[model samples]
Target: MNIIALKSVDLAIIALYFVAVLAIGFYLKRFATSGQDFFLAGREMTAWVAGLSFLSANLGSLELLGWAGSAYQYGILAAHWYWIGAIPAMVFLGIVMMPFYYISKTHSVPGYLQLRFGNGASGLSAITFAVMTILMSGVNMYAMAVVMKVMLGWNIHFSIWVSSLTVGIYVAAGGLYSAIFNEVLQFFLIWFGALLIPVFGLIETGGWSGMVARIQSNFPGQDFTHLWSTLGNAQDNPMGMHWTGIVFGLGAVLSMGYWTTDFLVVQRVLSAKDIRSAKMAPIIGSFFKMAVPLIVILPGVLGLAVLPEKLVPESALQAGQHSYNEVLPLMLARYMGPGLLGLGVTALVAGFMAGMAGNVSAFATVWTYDIYRPYIRRQAADAHYVSMGRWCTVIGLFISIATAYVAMGFASIMDYVQALFSFFIAPLFGTVLLGMLWKRATGPGGFWGLLAGVGSSVAMFFWVKLNPGALAIIALSDHAKPLAEDMYRALWSCLINVIVTVVVSLATQPKPLSELKGLVMGVTDIPKEQNVPLLHKPAFWAAVSIAILAILQWIFW
Candidate 1:
């Protein structure tokens, strides 16, 4: 409440950011004249550029604040999202899955589905992806406005309009080219702006040890500092989750679903210059992902140890009460002074805009290529589609702005939108995983299995919503929390998808082996990477990344 509005200097710094990103968009518009250029960044991005953009695409203000809030609520258990929920799947994407995606030469994930299954599966996947992107962009749009209202006391409507319009202008002008470059720039801004919180919070708390002692003293009988120590029993941890939920549900299903199959992040890898670059992009991203908990989760953990006033839940926030999600802004107001505060605000603003840009860019691609190309206007010229893609970006932003306003009325906006996204991801991953690895996975099998998988998830969601008592039955334990419920839901949906696909495939006529060329794994002639130098190879770096993950888990345990 005591935080001041942006000073003249801060306003100047933020203004420069808008000018810079707009400049990048306008400058690249000339280069992104073709469909390939606008949609895929001309497939010219080297590993490092693609890698940073891949990581930054998901580093939006909402992700940072929400996860930081998670740390405050659940403690070090939040790191599992960064580690178990991300690392292994990302490495698997780079090492195993990237080959199938890259070699098939599919424009989008749904495009890959179309080649492997048919129009039925592709249409289903594309439409769902388009809807998911719009909702997610709206979430990012709402997050930007929330940050502005919280820190500078700006009007929410003004914040939302300005952000959506700016993001729209750039992404519409240059498509993925604009989005990727801006995402890379935003990555640097985020680290510079947000890294200060953990640094100053540590100084106040003495260090990690002091913060641990303070949290332990504040919440007696709660296991808040250890990552895996109390995970054996659902009742032993603050998260109220067992290790099976962490390992099988989250680490296997949700992790693979989001990291490997979610098109938003995977689109960045699709822009890499070559196979090796595609393979290496996610590998590079894995290393930086390991460090994100330091900035995101640590700040919330620090807040639990040091904040003078307790924060409320999102629905409980009203009048003068601060929510857990407000911890970042509250900490900025507390420790940061003058110019640094401006940088922090700019970082959040950048994050929000870039998040919207990433979603809109991916939406434009899927809507134009996956949806419009095959269904609406099958005979359109490449230039016409490029024009349509540009138009789709602007249309998507308008929809996102509307969704942001709609989000204002909901108490559980995040949960509802996130559940919509989760409904498709785990099941879609199951379908794609089977289509790639199994020779017997027929077209009808993929379609019906995917629909049934998504249908079951939807059924389960409403069943729990209508009767809260059903959560204990579904999650397998009364001690399971809302987060744990999601993990179990994904695992169940994925399992159902795999089972249905197998059952249906056994009964249907199969596609001949001659027709399955680059699409299926066993039949595809994948080029070997053993000849590449060890330092340059993706497998070597992936191994090193796994080694680092193990060491961190052991230390945190």
Candidate 2:
């Protein structure tokens, strides 16, 4: 029944991984005595630990298989999600936003909003975030199930429940501490375990240049190898997108919206030992993030150069055709054998579990601190809140399982992810950005603007769902693909949120200047990093990251 067989060595490798993670969770159980310790890892993580955990937290659905499939489907344009869409926003989070978060000592992003805006904006953001994490976890779960089914012929139900239960048990035992530790472990596993594909593929093709030539021969007249060269017009590239969409839509809006504002990744940075570690975490992560395309994008484009048959879309998959989403596993089966295959599979499994843990842990935190503590039972003891966090972890996993079934309807999990990001992250970015920069932004304005922005996004989504013709208007391009639609949708929603926030703020009474200290930029006095050497400054590393990002674009162009 299996398309690719696993040896005993493979099964043993996977079993060991499960055992190690469970051991880690039980080992850390004693540390979850207090609310802060349970949720924030005792705030003692170093820059490197926090950085790898930060990037790894996002690696699950966003990085590995989903982006690889995008590479095969859209070509070199997929790197935009890695480079311009991530690096800049990460640097900005470190140098600009981390200070506000660190200084204010807020439990979550919504917690920050409550301090600056009020219960309305805070409560809404919390609910939206809680929902987004559940959907995002489902996306990661479905992604792993898809790969397992494709490569090993495993039943999707078996894969989902097994992985979900593993994550729930560990995360329930150790809270964010357990989740962050596993994420750190997964970063190394993912890179080393999966790097074999691109290595073997490139060797078979002779090199990068050889691989490019093979792709040219295989699909003549298509531009699948350049990052920015074919981005001038929608029809010029496989992505059916333009430079404006890549730059403003993706690089500016979606990238910033997710990286700076999304608490899932931001929470990792918040676990730093000090403000310096917090500032350096994203910068350090940015350096390694630049290398991800080597594993993700290369194997995808290599699939075009090497796969025996043309892969089909998800609709045709049930008819016995390969789906683009299966490209990673397909290539995995192509190159790896025996021990290496087991490591690769285990790595993928770890990624999925860690991604789920990240989502569930973040969801539990937001639900308990933001939703329950504020609204339901406001007088709970510290032990009671920690207990609630553990219970919510199990509940979040169940919701995610249901969401995984919902994810089955979508052809590409990445599309579902991007659409979900557009719904909440784009508008959330608007509220957070204005709340941080403009001291005059009022509670009523922040609340209503966030509501309107989210409303427009949902309305446009259903409009396009009911009438596909609406996409042409919404994206402003007849040739625009789903990727382009998501980009432009985020841009639109972000602009709408900002516009409404500005208008409403001007008409409403602002929070007093004295009350805005340590929360708003103009009114706050940031602490200088006294006595820290130049080598330790976050700005120095951020500049290095930016330079590398630019060089990568130039090299790949």
Off by over 4 Å in 1: 405-417
Report, for every candidate in turn, its global Cα lDDT versus the true structure.
Answer: 0.87, 0.91
After superposition on all C-alphas, the RMSD of every candidate to the true structure, in Å, is 1.4, 1.1
Q: Report how far residue 322 has shifted in candidate 2, in Å.
A: 1.1
Give me the runs in candidate 2 sitting further than 4 Å from their true place: none
Q: Output the lDDT of residue 300, model 1.
A: 86
Top-scoring candidate (lDDT): 2
Instruction: Give the Å shift of residue 359 in candidate 1.
Output: 0.5
TM-score of predicted model 2? 0.98
Residue 334 of model 1, lDDT score = 84
lDDT measured at residue 121 in model 1 versus the true structure, 0 to 100:
84
